[model samples]
Target chain A: MIAAPDSPGLVGPVVLSMKMAHRTHGEGATAVHALRGVDLEVRLGELVAVMGPSGSGKSTLLNLAGGLDTPTQGTVTLAGAELSAMDPRARARVRRRSVGYVFQDFNLIPALTAAENVSLPRELDGVGTRPAREEALVAMAEIGIEDLADRFPDELSGGQQQRIAIARALVGPRRMVLADEPTGALDSAAGEDVMRVLRARVDRGAGGLLVTHEPRFAAWADRTVFLRDGMVVDTTGGASGPESLLAGGGRHRGDR
Target chain B: MSIRHGIIALLAEQDMHGYQLKVEFERRTGGTWPVNIGQIYTTVQRLVRDGLVLPAPGERSDDRADVERFTLTDAGRAQATVWWSTPVERGAPARDELAIKLALAVTAPGVDVRDVVQAQRTESMRALHDFTRLKAAQPQTDDLGADLAWSLVLDHLVFDAEAEVRWLDHVEARVARASLHPRPSPRPTDDPAAGGAGGGRARRRSGAPPPGGRRR
Candidate 1:
């Protein structure tokens, strides 16, 4: 997917962060063209929600944006580095140093204790055990789960396990986070707490992209993007507030 | 509106006992909707608790007994209006998860196509039988709403189940015919023979390779 091209010279450390412009996909008769064309720009300190129905390609867009999937044809750039142009090894390094992820299922190692699970990402990035454990503890403390660090996944309830996942995703050298259906499994009360934590992360200057089915979850984002049949159907909270843009009535802020 | 709102809406016109409310609601729905007696009682209890409804002048006082007669309050009438006026966003139309799973299951190596069709066919038949039995036992009432609404749902459920069964039979026949013909190598993506070979290339290109040469 990623083929690193020769670095284009003359731009001194371009800092606008990630940008994906006009991505398209399709093939022959059997080919279902998932994404028509999408343009997105993510700078620092922003939280965006991607909302759509089952087959609308929000996941496809997320995969492209997070370096989990590639565009059939388009440019994807992150931190002045062209993501679509990078070799596999170099792309891996970029992801390790720049991105974090929280999945709907929590994705914690079931056999490991909370601290051990939290430490796995840093360890994967080659950070040693002792220091990784210390970092993990701090991250767990931030998410209010420091007391549960010694518990295995089965010992904790769903909400606690998700908190541990959040800590794990945040404990490394990552500047951005991609959460796919992060609150989908939790009940309303627990989901609200998790959203609060994510909102705090964005307030602290790390950008986030959350893909979800629930309208209530989208209410928390700085901006919301709605997709339909693999196209960007609507955008809310750019220059106009969500009230005007989401007035079609499918979704609106909880504040209303 | 909550379930209480639903009950309150029904009561705004007059007082009703628990059984009367259940019968009336079903009648109004044209017997299409079967309201559980338990749900009717529960909603009545909640409405009483909220002061949306009050027991009639000479009704049973015991909480455990069925609400013999209950009348809606002014507040309850307002609540009913809110229920009627407010609009709710609908979730996506239901799709068959089983269908997607079965379609993908055919590409798995060592899976027999005939077995897949037979299993789905059997399941749909059982579901259709259950639906048929319920339709036979439907309450006989002249209530227009109850009569029309239930008939519509029953018709659709039967139609969908029968259609699925027919599709499964056609698929089984096609698979049997293809089995008799000379088989060609499957495409790397859709063919079971290609299995692990084409698995991770898309994921690989999407991002960097996983640690220790593992693909994510």
Candidate 2:
């Protein structure tokens, strides 16, 4: 159960923000602190990359941001709603309407066509099948892959499949796509192609939190957050985006 | 690297004077390589001396330093073709400052290697972030050639910096692991014929500190 206060509405151009979040797994001697108190924000029209060594809690921060997991301490505000205050059912509905997730693996249903896989979310939201397919096509075209709509996931290349997955991420009323190394299993060229699509889509007024180890891919984001020992150590770039150093974000440059 | 060949390649397209060659070279390399007009002329003069370059037929000047256009000779063209076909040589690895610095830091007494690595990591990541911003600031144009040529090494610098950070992370893990299990100090020699524990330790592994071995 989550406690609800006055719930200051999630404000400004920011789509997601986590304040003083701490995620510890276990208790007492066996406890493992996944995320020490930390703060991060991804504004609309921005792609923020999270980079860290293994065990640095990049995935845990992502899970909290997407409403898939609640932080042990702090609130995750998504789409003007406080996730910490929501019950599980309400949280699920909010996630469906507000966040789209593209995983490391393609995660496409083999039985579904590319269009169907993209339109499936819209259908789940109770839209008519024909209208959903049309919207799916429009989304696919936005990402420059409408030609691959009829083909199943198996029929497409790794890059093309990821673009379709991006189309799915772009389709519903989602505000952000929390892509977890979406370029996994892709070669450099194919990986760049996928980032190009993701960048264009996010440029079209959606937010993105990209988790990647590849600098070439992270170079595409507005800014990159570096984590170490469950704490944010430094952040780079995002000069043109909103000021995200509101809490625990350190812009360390030079010989700091 | 080869200013002579660069000038040849430039002139292969059209006859160009020293200043023009300098400008063209800068443009082709996205300004990453800035060449002085003097260097251009020096290289051009060398080419002309070697019979690989000649003044354009229509261009003439009273003073040798005046604006004289250069054109690649037949031999120059042939050399350019060969250069195009050949691969750039990567010789044996040269000494890198950071590599040397870290090597010394790990072994040097009274030095915290992890701190050094973190400092360098922050600096490297900052540079990478700057490179990324430089890349992102460029509004992609429809001209693919121009876009690709905008800053050929900008993305390369990004990749290099990223690699540096990854390498630093690796170094940190190795250092941390070493600290956790300090190499067992060699037992003091039982026989008086052998020297003290100091000699054995002197020959032991370098930078193997007893991490977390200090007790309350």
Candidate 3:
């Protein structure tokens, strides 16, 4: 039962917050409810894994939380700032400055080296080239891949490439990371490596949301939320330990 | 089961006494399967009777002597070599209590299969966590053989637990589907998107291709 510490620097319990969020697509006869009144609060030093069958609104929840998409009904707050209230440009700025994203595929640029791939985000955020490069090197070192800094993504193995992608996600002062099946492309050993990196990152006071189909990968998270039919049907709270599964019966059928 | 061949294999490496064999076996296997001294002596006596092992030259003939070392015979060497190359037999499925329990629960009256599955899942997950913690506590050693052997043991346990969890999920899903349709029939829809009302909604939301098509 590892709980997030109550730090004075933070405003409240949650870091990237969502409250009664709902997202509906299209109009009238074709309206599809992607997410229905979801309330999630990921605190600092927490990695929450979203687990569900295909098309269960897991990605929609992530998109809303990261400000890539807005909720139709409720609000999302990231780092104490209300994302729904912010304009598009302001939201984009917040996304760049505070949020990090890791896609299923290793989205590293083929032309850029590992260091350059990691530093590109920082440079885009108006960081000087030297400082960005330094930060990228530091991040690469953190993941034990500093030696691969100058190597292109093609030269690295799948595990190495994923590590570089993680380094990219953690390059700046981003407080929240959203990973969509980051281990999808990796083997079990490689997948565990990526999970270890992500877990270490979250343990260092960054909140993360990992979307994974594999229960083994989800086991690494602090908690797991099971989504079905655009709603959270079950939640394994605090720690994704075996005891949590036994604490509640099958499908609590309520919102958290 | 493997203790027989394991002892033979260690003897093939060097002549060792009973206590030394026990210590070496535990060291190589990361102490996961501790060999009792009585078991070692019994196994050694059996091997001796089978002519796979012989007392080393200059060693006393007394059975209780600690300094008396045993060396592998030609037959033992050949057997150990075969053990190295041959795979473990898996034709006869092992009798597992959990599997038996689940099978009984499914057929037993007044028994909730879901509850049984949930309980087993929790126990398996707890075992997985304990194994993970034990693996983490192991100090990294320069002896690659021992390190690899220990890691393989840990991996076997982890994979087994993961498979158990997956099996439980499958069982729960099957039970749920059966309850939904009293008379079970083949699933109607092959298209995952058109499988059910919820599936249709999910497909409409993310028109992007499903998580398939990538190399598993």
Candidate 4:
């Protein structure tokens, strides 16, 4: 773990921000720098897609954004609180209350029914069971899967399971969704369905940080960040990416 | 599908004049690929000559009859069925100028292949982003059956642009890896510029279209 000092900055309506964040694994001769000080922000109602070739730090960035991993240097702000400065207990509480995660696989519990799986996070945050279930239903209905709430994960199709997973990610007081290739396991049509649901949720004010290499899925985001050799190299639309700095002279991206 | 088949497919639904056919084709395909009125009339005249369609009810026989509604004959209907049933043949590679340009760049002098790749990638991503913005503006109402054609055509552009970007990335990686070591084979023995002709870099253009090259 790295020690974090609280720094003055206004993250504003942004749900997540990573300023000069670096994550290096191991040490000395074999140190692998997963991220080399990348700055990013996911504002409310914006879905930012991270796209790069293999080993370009897409997954590492997602982990740091969701507070699953701490940065080696720089601040990670989630919901206006600096994650790197928080103690483990406080960080976990913020992650449970403010952040929702969706992985490539559905990641639903096999034993629990869909409703229970969706409600589990709320329950873990100390909400009563009945209220948690009600929130779960609301999330499912938001994604148009209220009818499949009682079924177990194994019984549903991949697309249905993924929609349920998205509902779980959107449930309760969660203000941000961190999805790592949320459509990777499904076919093109089913993948479109997943992207649609994710985009709809983001449009309704839940910030999204989506990691995907597939350009079609990446298109669902408001902007895209391209990483190369553990650095931000280019960005398309709505991103003040590091590339503008790398290119020398800060030209307004709106003119690009 | 080719414009020929597209016209036939649309006509199978109902008889339409040339302007109507052009508008319908563009409408069905999201207006991404536009067809000129002259091209449509020329193709229709050829279809009539081949007995696949005929000018309806007291219209001129020449192709200048743009107002003449054309109806599909049985042969045209059969062609429409084939177009609908058969998957678009994609086994054979098309003539790609980008592939050719990149293939030349790795071997040419005075050209940074990476820059070439990166520039092309930026262009492709820009196109992909534009298509994505257009898609977001397009309505995706629940009656997808009516909107399926438009959506599919729009996605075709997005997917193709996406593939182009991926291919460029792959090319960049492979070129970076290969250029690490010098070529093992002997260099070309043409002596014109081999011995430092003119004591300056007198290399020919690395990536320029020569005379009579394909423009479009």
- Can you list the residue pairs that collide in candidate 4? none
Cα lDDT computed for each candidate against the true fold: 0.66, 0.79, 0.77, 0.80
Candidate 4 per-residue C-alpha lDDT over B1-216 given as tens digits, one digit per residue, 9 for 90 to 100: 358888899899999999999999877765545778999999998999999998876766665676789999999999999989998766656667788899778877778998898777766765566556656655675575537776786677678777788788777776776677656533445666656555424544333233342111
Compose the digit string of candidate 1's lDDT tens values, residues A167-233.
Answer: 8877866657789999988986577568767765555556678897654455456556766668775
> Candidate 3: which docking quality band?
incorrect
Model 1, docking class: incorrect
Error of 1 at A61 (Å): 1.2
Question: Could you say which candidate leads in lDDT?
Answer: 4
Q: Could you tell me which residue pairs clash in candidate 2?
A: none
Lowest-lDDT window of 10 residues in candidate 1 chain B? B207-216
| Model 4 ranges with Cα > 4 A deviation | A1-12, A239-256, B12-14, B57-67, B72-95, B109-112, B141-146, B179-216
Interface RMSD of 2: 11.4
Q: How close is candidate 1 to the true structure, as a TM-score?
A: 0.49
TM-score of each: 0.49, 0.81, 0.78, 0.80
Instruction: Give stretches of model 1 more than 4 Å off.
Output: A1-26, A239-256, B1-216
Candidate 1 colliding pairs, count:
12
For candidate 3, the C-alpha RMSD (Å) to the true structure equals: 10.2
Cα lDDT tens digits for candidate 1, B1-216: 134555777898888988889888867644534568899888888888998888887777677466579888888888888888988545554455666666556556788876676566544544443343344345434456655576555546556665665566556544555567635534445545644754634532212233342111
Give per-residue CA lDDT, model 3, range B50-93, as digits (tens).
99999888887676667789999999999999999999766666
lDDT of 3 by residue, A104-166 (tens): 789999999999999999999999999999999998887788999999989989888988988
